[model samples]
Target: MFRRTFWFTAGAAAGVWATTKVNRKLKQLTPESLAATAANKAIDAGHRLKDFAVDVRDGMAQREAELGDALGLNDQDAPELPPQRRIAAIENRTYPKYTYNRNEDH
Candidate 1:
């Protein structure tokens, strides 16, 4: 009688453990749970990307300042211009024009 009781208790414990594991897996596979996990990963990636962009911008600015010091350009002489003024300055530069003659053979 004691042996039979022990076997029954062991079986019951195994069944309970198996049921708990299967239920946990099913919960993870549900649509809402899957979407929430994916969204969390995406938000984490976005934060990492933002931090990387800020670091790159800061490094570029530091390099620019170092180059200015090497070239003996002071802040007053080389004031930082807004995007519109920079575009205008680039557009205002003059380059020598070249004429192309297709009929001339070399």
Candidate 2:
């Protein structure tokens, strides 16, 4: 009875090992399946990038229109301003000192 039980356990282990080897061989036989999966992923990524570009362009146009309205100018008449010039204007007009206390102590 003990010998029979040992043989049965060994057969089950061998069956599992053989099944894994067959599965690996089957995957190796189908190269086109792997290539198709990679191509599909690339196409998906390209579509997502195109969508993002359209969204960014739309947002920038909307923001420019709003800024033109606030400045009391038509969108076509709005003057183009560089970011650096705007920053410099704000920095020059705004005081940097935090307090009027000129004394070093007290």
**Winning model by TM-score:** 1
Kindly list the per-residue Cα lDDT of model 2 for residues 19-89, writing each as its tens digit.
99999878856878778878898999999999999999999999988987898666556577767644444
- In angstroms, give how far residue 92 of model 1 lies from its true place: 28
- Stretches of candidate 1 above 4 Å error? 1-11, 79-106
lDDT of each: 0.92, 0.85
In the range 1-106, model 1's lDDT, one tens digit per residue, is 9999999999999999999999999999999999999999999999999999999999999999999888877555667666763334466788999888988757
**TM-score of each model, paired residue for residue:** 0.58, 0.45
Report lDDT (Cα) of residue 52, candidate 1: 100
- List candidate 2 stretches off by more than 4 Å: 1-30, 75-106
